[model samples]
Target: MDIDTESTATSLDENTENFCDNPTRDTIAEGLMGLIKPTVDQLDERVRATRLSQVELRQCIEGLSEELKRISEDQKHSIDLEVYLKKLINAKQRVTVLSNILQSAQERLNRVHMSIDKETVKRKVLLNNTIEDPHSVVLSKNIGSSMSLQTPLYNLNDFPDVYEPSEDTHLFIDALEKDMKYIINSKPTLACEIGCGSGVLIAALAKILKSTCCYFCTDINPKACIATTRTAKMNKVPLECTRMDLTTNLKCKFDIVLFNPPYVLTEELEIFGCGLNRAFAGGLRGRSVTDRLLNNLNDILSDNGVCYLLLLKENNIGEIGEKMGEKGFKIKLVIQRKIPGEHLFVYKFSKA
Candidate 1:
């Protein structure tokens, strides 16, 4: 019985020791797992939330990228529009310049056409007339009358640079014709024409007088000098033409002085140059060139000299007459005619 009781005690002791050791280890491991498992689950939840936030952030970035791309395209379109607008403006300027150029070309062409028409008319007149002499022709105011006046020989083509004879020229000739008897009675020794364009007036005077009286002409244009010589030779008249500014440096006084000055109002810049501008461009009320001649008239004229000046109404004829009166001169309106928009007049001035 004693041995049996001892064996039972030993076995019970071994069983208790094994049970305590194994069960304690298992309880400790289970407790550690329970605490760790909850912590790991919390960490896993936080990680999932972080991943969701990352996905939302990535979506937001993609949306912003789309917005930026749209903005970039819009900016690019605006730039293109600006470029097109600038090009359009440039094109408009170019078109304006071309238009002005075309207008100027048209004006020049019209002038050329008018010149050609004038030449044609002159040729037709010459052909129609039965001229006794090719160099000259007797012009009769009364048809079928033996009493006739001779005209200076002139070809329009010979004086291209000279101002063509217009109504003013004819009007001046008519005035001279009306006073031809008086002029012949005066028996002038010297006669001069200022701004003699075609030498028609002086040559006509020489023809009518048929005298050995000296004829002098002065012109600003050098071409006019050549034209005057040609006209005088063609008409068998003696004439001395000098390229000068209205009798500058001429020491002789004249009994008869004629001037057909530029009577068209124009810019000051257009006055006092070569070409047709010098013929027609009278600065400021068409008095620039005329005033200079008037200022020096008394010095250039003889005591009994007569000055026949052609003037437009725009030349302030009243003012010119008043100024001439102050200079001990009398003004007489020899002839006046109105044609188109202008009224032209020839005034004879003599010492009072």
Candidate 2:
């Protein structure tokens, strides 16, 4: 009885080992079956017509065949193992044929892609060839040319509706709103936005302060002014839009004045070409408008009023603070937000 029990346990262990060692034929067959559909699809589509190299596909098949053949012949195993080995050899051959088909399809696709890329490059070269450098702008002077616009100075193409608010703008607006609340709590009468575009900034101020104070939106570009006015009306905010070229057209002063000037530096003039639109062109060194505005900042800025000016890092508008000191006005940045890739300077100034 003891001998019989020991033999039974040994036999059970061998069976368990065989069961674990055996490969599942169904799993291998399923994997091979998955390749068949994709290969057949490629063949039916005549993907080889596009200049695919059949040589590469042949190489893949040869590799799989070599691997499968070695595994089948070199390994002397049980009948179950031998049967599945034969199936693997067949699947490997099928993979080789599929590789050839896929290679041909890719070669054709490659040719088509090359042709499209070449055409695109040609068109870009032609367009760039026609584009004149900024230095040549002085030579192409015509009185009524597109460059001759006065008040609506910026070309419509200069500013694009990005549809997304930039991180810098978000931070700047938040800071501005906070400062706006401080001012409104103290002297909330009339608020004016200079160089307002799309009405986003002013609309935010309106919503935050929630005051019936008259809001004035002004932009040098007629299109910007009109768009901002429409946005204000849509949002049910009582605001007035006027085409005021900050250099000339603006006449009145307000209790609170907001200026977000186009302060992109000279080094980045590639963005703004010869079209000196009121929205973006900052003159030869990118400080022309900023310099003029700072000089006359006291005019539009009320006697005992607050002014919030958003300036670029390049524009040394901090010099304005020194000038304000001479006029007995106290000016501070109040709230500042440094955006990655660019710097925005916001100052809150009041008469001393």
Candidate 3:
């Protein structure tokens, strides 16, 4: 009963080869799966952070508004001066809350990116080894990857620019950019964005203009300025960020001047500490900062320059335009949007 020994040897060889291939495939799949898990976990953490902060920040802003009202009424009479001071002190706590919200949001975003980097590196290793189906593996890895890894308008880390598109801020930025596209295409030169919150629109403008002779960016908040700097760097847009309030005169002359002032009106009085109040609360009708910015805008813009300004309709856009008209400025309606729960008009005005 002599078996066909050569045939038996060939069958064993084929079986061994099949066994090796199956294990190799399994190893590749396992490595890819491992790489995806951490990134997904990290992304979930970021989404949670963003949601929590959004709620917290809104609450802080509302609290600050109430405190402002109390302080305003207190200052009307001389007897309540001491009480006013105490209220001012309490407002500082609200500012702290706002800061914490921003910090949390930032930390969560960082964690997501870190996780993405680690997973990407590991996935690449697996992909390289599985050359027989590298493309499919890469596609699978990407589908399973968890991270808000979309290329932002710019790099937030390097640009330090704030690009908060949610709520009223989004309306302000989107409208301003649309109107300016015409001028940006016609005249490509130096431009400056004042109070560049998140720098979302500035980055868009930079992308449009392509070659700017000089781009100056300013924000009164140190954090915002830093963010703007990072955003500019991330987008590869050349710009300088400075801490400057619109009430003060700016040194450089720009062909284009853009600003979106905090138009929310609050009655809080703080001599030295403006806090989060300065960021958004416009006085009585939310036009305090807008008025000041408009008053000083003429000083910063070139004689032949055009300026694009953002103001909420609730903040008295019509009244603002009337005042600018009296100042010998020509106003053009750039964009008007009635967003649910928000009302604003972005105008393009030039001194005549």
Candidate 4:
């Protein structure tokens, strides 16, 4: 046992050396493991956070996509509404235009109806009565009578602005011719013609009567007054012409009053000026100018005065006669003539 103790000590020394080397290696391995484990734990936490952020980003993108889809739908609806509103506005404008056109058409139709009714009445009257032709009557009387054939003294070129004598003028003169005997018998002291266009009617009256009665003529148109004066001068008739409005300035009453007036139906706006248009622009069924004259008849006429008024068939002669009757005046249809598309009449009014 004593001789083996050295060998045993050598074995123990070898065992201790081995144990020390192993502890050194184990300590280094444990330190490396500590550092590596902390780094690995931090990396794992970062990865988890990145995954959570990715999930949130995906949710936010889907929400934005849904919002965009709703906005697109809303914009489409707004565009549709705008288009519908424009169409409605256009339709309203078209309706307004059509209403105006319809109103104009209705007015025209009413005028036509009136004309047709008038023509029908005239045709019936012609069938019932042996109405003499006015032109033939005038010609026959002229041929047999000693009275000279009266014509317009003023030439058309003399007063271009004055209303030229037309068929109406001839009709008026013919009517006067038919009533010549009555007029001569009445012995008018003062004769006046309202709205004397070319002084033809007054001039003829002066020539027919051949009496020394005062003859006066009035016209709103200054050119007409001048033409009237010129016509009287040319015809060697003693005529006094005045530029006045329908006996407005005259104080003396007339024994006889003559008015041709503007007997064509027209709008009031067309009768504004004292031009040639005023000669024929009778407003509202051709009675605007005539009604004024009728209302003022009592004031301007003498006790035994006679008013000769020219009127169209459309003027409603029955209504006019009634109105005159109410004014204490008797009305007589002295003469009537039917021309193409129109009927003309001369009404004689005198105090009852």
Candidate 5:
């Protein structure tokens, strides 16, 4: 009975060894592969578009095909221990072969990735240029057309008594050119420049619009009117010269109005005083003449009117804006520039 029990125990041990060997190993290997496949498949997809040279990629694909063929052949002949042993050997070889191919694939994929990165940057630059073309083209064309107005020729003799093209005058014109787009959109019909000395300001605008609109000027001095008319004729712009004191006589509603007023602070007696003094005399902070027109400006301007007024820093622009605001007008502080003695500002006013 002892001998029989020993033999039975040996048989159980052999069966247990058989149960835990190759078949169990294959099951565990398949289970591990099942767990890793999703992540590996994802990585494969990410690199597939730019991995390996065409020739090398094809070779790798063929290698994988051969490996599948070899496995298929081994499965077909798996009717004996020799076949199973060969499959085990082949499986080890497959691991080594796949590892080598995958390493080669990684090296090639890195090179391809670098090339793609370079190409992508170049493509992005091209894309940006193409995108900007549509939006910028119209604006650039408009700017090109607007900027075509060169500085009009000024004869010192024609405007001898009137103020010459001084720094303030040049700055006023520059600011006008800067806001040309807004002025063009406003499309003023009856535009007037009060205190239009030598007609330089009106002529400049007339030339820009090619005399498509009627432009007029007002001055208290008859000699100024003569000088302005002569200056306008020289520039070949049709400008109506009116001898008046700050739009006091005329009740015409103007769409666009410009004034480079007498902004020098002086005593009350010097307000519109003698020869050149009349040109630039402002009593007590240069507000005398400017305030007079501004008080009744709403009636002078049309519904879609815009006024451009030049002032010095001492003129208390904030207070002026507040006063204008109370009279149903809003002010835009357009441009300010400082030179030798004075800080000049150009203010634009429109109905609120």
Candidate 6:
């Protein structure tokens, strides 16, 4: 506290004359300052501690705010993950459903295609009946030929395991028709056919010589054997069938042999494989099955047995003739036909 000049003068006058000689005003002021100094220092220390505590509290508040923000972000991220998983599940289910629907649609389309094919065939048959003789059929011709080799959809539906007669089969029948007179002249007692699909070949022979000859056929497929028997019954011909691989187990000496082999080029493994492949899967150069038969032709034939077989252009006819010539057999091409995607020939083999 600052003292007024008048107050200091009065105080100095009231003090002892000896104190006045020592500057009493200055001494009192110094004493008062000394008494208040410790309290001032204590107040200063308290202020500093309060500021430090405030700073620490502010820092702690800031850390808590940061922690709350992190928790909020984590919550948001967890929600996002849950939504993503849900979307993935939904998409997967949709894709699976679509796949099943597409598969069903494809199956329906195939059925529609089959129905259309059958309808078309039926219409054609009706049209043919109107134009030609009503007694004649779409699958057969009786214009002086020994057999009608035309095929319709019935063969496929009736016998799925059996080969459906096509161009090769027709060509084979035409070849036999051309050589029918020669076959009759020979007057064979026993006739056998190898791999007689649909039994058309043997049935044709049986019809012409039913009384004089015994007709027999061998087929790798039981369905073909059944087809042969059925064909014989239809044409009023007597025929017997045995399930054998290219005359492998025949006990009779056949005077006439007919073969319409699988002549399409394919893998060797498919030569004897299951299904329709056995009908048309000719191995390398389309000669595996044909060659095997040719190798044993000498033993398979009788003294005057004549064998007729169908061959493809890929089967190397020159090599076949040379090989047959070596085995004392004469090979003559009876009939040839070019149809669609194939060039085919029916050859006659006779002992020289």
TM-score between model 4 and native: 0.59
Best by TM-score: 1
- The all-Cα superposition gives candidate 6 an RMSD in Å to the true structure of 19.0
lDDT of 1 by residue, 1-352 (tens): 9999999999999998998789778999999999899999999999999999999999999999999999988887645575567455434433433444355346545867987998798777766674645766745455334324534566557556677656677678878877878788888999999999888889878866776579999999998888888888888888889999998879999999999888776656778677766877677677899999999999888998999999988789999988889989999989998764458899998888
lDDT of each: 0.80, 0.62, 0.67, 0.80, 0.77, 0.77
Candidate 2 lDDT by residue in tens digits, 1-352 = 9999999999999998887776786577778989898988888677665335576777889999999998898676645775567455434433433444355346545857987898688667656656745334233244236421111111223235311123334555756655754766766567888777667667777765556577887766666776676667766677888876663665667777777665554323333422223344344345666666667777877787787776665566666667778977788876675543455677787877
Which pairs clash (backbone N, Cα, C closer than 3 Å) in model 4?
Answer: none
- Name the weakest run of 10 consecutive residues (lDDT summed) in model 6: 148-157
Off by over 4 Å in 2: 1-165, 267-278
Candidate 2 vs candidate 3, TM-score winner: 3
- Candidate 6 yields a Cα-based lDDT of 0.77
Q: Give candidate 1's error at residue 291 in angstroms.
A: 0.8
TM-score, per-candidate, Cα-based: 0.60, 0.49, 0.54, 0.59, 0.57, 0.57
Q: Give per-residue CA lDDT, model 3, range 247-293, as digits (tens).
A: 25566677887777765445645212434446666655667667777
Provide the lowest-lDDT 10-residue window in model 3.
147-156
lDDT of 6 by residue, 24-67 (tens): 67899899999999999999999999999999999999999999
| TM-score for predicted model 2 compared with the true structure | 0.49
Residue-wise lDDT of candidate 5 within 9-104, one digit each (tens)?
999999888877768788999999999999999989867755656669899999999999999998897566765674554344334334443453
Candidate 5 TM-score, C-alpha based: 0.57
Which candidate, 4 or 5, would have the higher lDDT against the true structure? Answer: 4
Give model 3's TM-score versus the native structure: 0.54
Report RMSD (Å) for each prediction in the order shown: 16.2, 31.4, 38.3, 18.9, 34.3, 19.0
